[model samples]
Every structure is written in structure tokens, then in C-alpha cells.
Target: MDILKSLGHPEELINLFKFKIGGCRTIMPKLDYESMSESLRTCYQYLNQTSRSFAAVIQALDGELRHAVCIFYLVLRALDTVEDDMSIPLDRKVPMLNDFHTYLYQDEWCFTESQEKDRKVLEDFPTISLEFRNLAREYRDVISDICHRMGVGMAEFLEKKVGSMKEWDQYCHYVAGLVGIGLSQLFSASQLEDPEVGQDTALANSMGLFLQKTNIIRDYLEDTQQGRAFWPKEAWSQFAGRLEDLAHPDKLELALSCLNLLVTDALRHVPDVIAYLSRLQNQSVFNFCAIPQVMAIATLSSCYNNPMVFQGVVKIRKGQAVTLMMEATNMRAVHTIISQYSQEILQKVSVSDPSREKTLHTLALIREKSTLSQSSLQSRTHHLSPMYLSAAMLLAALSWQYLNTTAVQTQGTGDMQG
Candidate 1:
């Protein structure tokens, strides 16, 4: 029924149908939960409880790299929980952030005081830290170093507003870009990817910045309501006296102008994203990285010049997200998705908008880089009629039901034999 509702988007409908009928298993293989040690199992539990989006990809990672990345995410999530809890005084919060890395080594160091949503990771710190210590020496070093650096960076920003574009970049580097760098390093240490993947810090930083900027743009209202400001004063000051003013109904037009400008700034990192993804030779790693980058671009497309950004949350549709998860498995498909969404943003550009020229120039560069050849473009065009999509969806639904019934019957038969 959801697929039927998305019939207008035939590609998304088809992808949704495929995803519902076990295609996701092919893309994201399940891990052996019962086989893991108690601490690692608990860590995985904490991971899923903390972030569903990341848990799927992290589990899909190849071999020991999966465990490494899972522990890495839980560690950082615990650190972020500390930073997010506004009730913590500056002196205490700053020390926690700066010393977050050391806590990974302490057996009984858990912070049960945090009121943040994901504070369970902190409360169960021993489980997460024990798993962290079990990681290979190289993985531990990489995760610990990145955590320490990121903690200090978060501490520095706690006392400052994002005053300039450079500061915005710096803040994102501390919070997110460093995560990208650490992941790349872990990929290398796992020996599953090239050492150069970790060595390319600039491209890795861009990957993180692109996603971070998009999130900041999309979360304008939520951030403002929480008394948190991430949009650089250098950008928002041009259109409004205060960042919160942009949320006023009377300032909608100017708010959109400010949004467009930041979106353009975020788009500047696309070429680097392309370069970074192109260097990835591992399929699992590529899927893990590519899916999020494509989603960020799709999200940016949704938020571009859209007034819903300030009024409330703006997010990509579920069908669209499913399509991206399926299609972004390869570089050519990534290029197509990026090209398609960048073109969508191009169509929405306003001539009188404050960031018109900059937006056009950045998008043009992206199009030139991502544009497929004529033959490739021709092969990608799907002209499936709505009738066919509906029929396909129906068949997929029936197939799904049959598969579940067969699995149940097989289990019953095994029990009877036993």
C-alpha cells in the first residue's frame, strides 16, 4: 500500500517493493548476535538503541571492521550525549569532553548523570569501554586519538558561537569531520581498504562537512528552540538581525535567501565527496559511505529554498531514502543520484535570491562533474507505467507473505522432527 501510494515515483516504488521483499538482506547482511561476547553484545545493543540509521550500516561492515566501527560510534555517541545535555555546567562539561578518551580506559568510569536521550551509552560505559579495549591496538589508537581531539574541539566550541564561515568549518571538523577521518583510518587499519583512504584528510573532511552543513540547515527551528545556534553569524547576519528572526513569518523570503546561501556553501564540497567515494575500493565501505552522502544531497534538495525548513523539520521521503539505499551501492548510480538531485536544486534557484550566482556556479560545477554520458543517461531512464508498478508491488507483497509462511512451516517441521 505504501508502494502503491508512491506510484507517481515509479523508481522509488520499485525500490520500495524490492526493499520490502528481501533486497535489503542482500544489501545489508545480518550479523551473528548470539556469537558475540557479552560485552560486545551489550555494546551492539547500545548501538541499536542509540542510532538505528548507523547501526544497520555499521553491522553491514566487513569482518572485524564492523565491530571496530560499532564501538567507535557508541563511544562518540556517549561523548556527544555529554555535549548535548545543557544542564551540565561549563566547568564539568568541558572537563568531561576533554577527558572523554581517558574514560575508555577506566573499567568503572560511567556517567549516569547525563539527561540526554542517548545517555544510556554513558550509563553503560563499562560495556562499551570493555569492547573498545578489546579492539585491535591500531583500532583502539585511532578511536582513542580521534575521541580525544574531538572532545577538546567540542570543549572549545562550548564557549563560542559560530562567528564566521571559517569557525563553522572548524566546529564541524571537531564534531563530524574528525569522525570521517577516524573511520577512514579504521578502514585502513582493518586492511580492508587502501592506506591512502585514511591519508586523504581534506577529502574526508569535506564528506563530513557536506553532511553536517545539511543537517544544520534542516534543523534550524529545532536548534533555535533549544537555544543552540550552529548557523554561522557570517551567513545568517546578512539576512536577519538575529538568527531566530528568520523563523518569523514576515521574514520568510529573507530566511529562504539565507538558507539558499548556506545550501550553496554546503554544495561546494560535492566534488570532494565524489573524489573520496571514487577512491573507495571496498563495496561494503562504499555502500556505508555513499548511502549517507547521497541522502545528504537529497536532503539538501528538499530544503533548498523550501520554507518548511524554518517552519518545521524537512526530511526526504521514506520511499526516496529506500531508493537511495538500494541504488547508491555503486559509483555510477551515485553519480546519477547526485546529478538528478543537483538538477532539482538548480531548477529551484531564484534570480533575485541573495545567493543566486554562487548557487548556480556551485551546482553547475557539480553537474559537470556528475553528469553521465549520453549512453549511460539513456540506459537509466525507466518509463514503467503506473499499472505495471502496481502489479509489481502486488506480486512483491504476495511473495513476501509466501516467504514468511514457508519459513514458519519449515520451523514447525524442524520442531516436529526434533
Candidate 2:
């Protein structure tokens, strides 16, 4: 069904087929689970459980850096779970957020009382904190520092709503930008990348901001429906009476205007993203960083000037995501992906839209930074005919079915032998 939805995107369809049949190992290699320590293995389990989008890239990270990042992610995931659970009293939540860093040093500090779905991390904090303590001092220092700052930042925001653009950036910086900086520091600490990758805070912050903003833009309905709001009041108030009012059927024009304005704000970070990716030296680290940024741009392209954002979810197709995962391994491929999506957004720009000029200007800067030659800009699927795409999708579906049946039969045979 997903393949059928992506019939117009033949390259993505092919990439999707390749990914399903184990070609993804070439792009995203997994760590050996059985060889891991009990605590480390548990951390990976929580990573997979908490983040569908990030677990693969986190696993694909090279060497000890992979373990460090896995723990870092789990720590933040636990922190975010605490912040996100509205049922937690403000007094308890505020202190926990402020002192989340200190909890890393405690040997038995698990909190099983939380009601969030990913609360297992909090429920089993001792295991995670034990692993955190086992990390090398440099890696531990970076993770703990980011956790402390991010905790403090999360606490501060709990008392208020996002009122201004600057406040929005501050909030994203605390939650996400700090993750980028910490990961860069981990990469450098592992001797896989240069010190400047961690030291250049501005670029790292921008890397985080780009992904965070894209998520905030795309999740408008889900966030608002959940009684959470991340969009700045300063921007949304310009379009309607209240932020929630943008979702009303009668206010779609205003809703679209507000969405475009936020999308433009997100685009302003692309130049910084390009610069940040350019500085990456390790192939694994680059893939880890680049794939998400490209996916963010592709998502923004889908959401730009589109009303689906207000009505429901807006996500890039799974095939498109697989294509990005396969192709975004090198700087040149990343540039092409960013350039292609930038052009998609440009094509959707409406002249009467309030953010049209700013949108065009930001996109122009992105093109100038990320654009390659005209030949490189051509679509990968341009040569495929409708007949070929249809045949390919059919073959992929049949192949998947055969593989699944064979696996099930093999498992049955093993069970009978046992």
C-alpha cells in the first residue's frame, strides 16, 4: 500500500524495496546486541522503543561514540518524558528537571511512578545511570553537562507558553540544539571528528534548531490537540484569534498563512545546516547527522503552503524516507537532496502569501549554498516509465511476501526440531 502511494516516485520505490531486503545494512549497520553488557543492551532496547526515527542512526554511529550517544539519548528521553507528562505536579517536575543531571550520579534513583508511555526509562533509571557512570570521563562530562542545561531550560519553559520567536529558539536550543552540541562533542571525544565540530556551538545549535523547528511545524495538529503548543504566539496571533483557531475550517487561509510563516522561519536555518554538515569528517557521524537534516527538509517541502498540516498529519512517504536514508551518505548527495527539496518549496510559494518574500529569500540562500550543477539536479526517477514503475512495485510486493512466508516456515521448522 505504501509502495502504491509512492508510484510516482520510482526511485523511492526501488530504494524501499532494497531497504526491506537487508540493503539497509550497508547504510545503517547495527551493533551486536548479544556482545553488549547487560546495561548497555538494555539502553539500546530503550533507544529502539523510544525513537522510531533515531534508533537506526544512533546504532549506526561508529565505535564507543555509539554507546555514548545511546546513553545520552536515553537520558534525554527520560527527561523529556518527565517534562511531557502533564499529570506530574509542577513542583515535583520543576525540581526533577532542574536536578536531572545530578540523578545520573546516583546509583539507585529509578522513578517508577511516572505515567508516560516511555516511562520505562525512568522506571529503570539505575540501569541507565549505571551505564552513564561507566562511560569515559570526557563523554560522561559532555552528556551530563547537556543534561543539566537542558533540564534547567525545560523547567523554565514549564511556567509559560512560547510567546516570541526568540523564546521559541531558546526552547528548541535547550531541548535539541544541546543534543547536537553534545553529540558533536562525543564524536570529537572518540577521535572520529575534529575538535571544532564540538567547539563551533553556533553551527551545532542550528543543526538542532532545523530538525526541531521542522517537527514543531509538522506536528501542529497533534501538538495542539494534545493541549500543547510550541508555535510562537507572536507568529500564530497574526493569522487568527487564537492558535487553535487556525485549525477551524473557516480559517484555512489564515491557517495556511501562519503555517507558511513558520516554515519560512525553519528554512532560515538551512544555510547553517549545510555549513555544519560540511564540517563533518567521519562517514558514520556524517550519515548520522546528515540523514535527519535531509529528512527535515523533505518534510518541510511536504508541509510548505499545504493545508494538510492544519487538518491532519503531514509526513513524507516511507519510500521517500528510505530513499533519503540510502542516498544521504555523502556530502554531494546531501546537497542534491537539500537542493531538490528547496526547489519543491520554491515551486509552492504563493505570491499573495504574507511570508512569500522572506520564504523566497531564505530559499535563495539555501540554493546558493547547497545547489550543485544542473545535471546533478535532475530527478533520479525521470527515465522510468509508468509501465516500469508498476512492474517494479508488483515485483517488490511479491518478493516481500515470499521472504515473509519463508521466514515463518523456517521458524516453524526450528520450533519443531527444538
Summed backbone clashes in each candidate are: 0, 0
Q: What is the TM-score of each predicted model, taking all chains together?
A: 0.93, 0.95
Colliding pairs, model 2: none
* lDDT tens readout by residue for model 2, 279-394: 88899999999999999999999999899998888988887888898899988988898888998999999989999999999999988897588887675436767797789878
TM value for model 2:
0.95
Report the number of the highest-lDDT candidate: 2
In model 2, the Cα lDDT at residue 102 comes to 98
lDDT by residue (tens digit), candidate 1, 1-418: 3444455676765676576566777778868988989888898888877777777778889999999999999999999999999989998999999999999999999998888889899889999999999999999999999999999999999999999999999999999999999999999999889999999999999999998999899999999999999999999999899999999999999999999999999999999999999999999999999989999999999999999999988877767888888889999999888888988999999989978999999988987777577577567777678687778767755664565578687763111000
> What value does the lDDT take at residue 159 in candidate 2?
96
C-alpha RMSD of candidate 1:
4.8
Model 1: lDDT to the true structure:
0.88
Computed on alpha carbons, the lDDT of every model, listed in order, comes to 0.88, 0.89
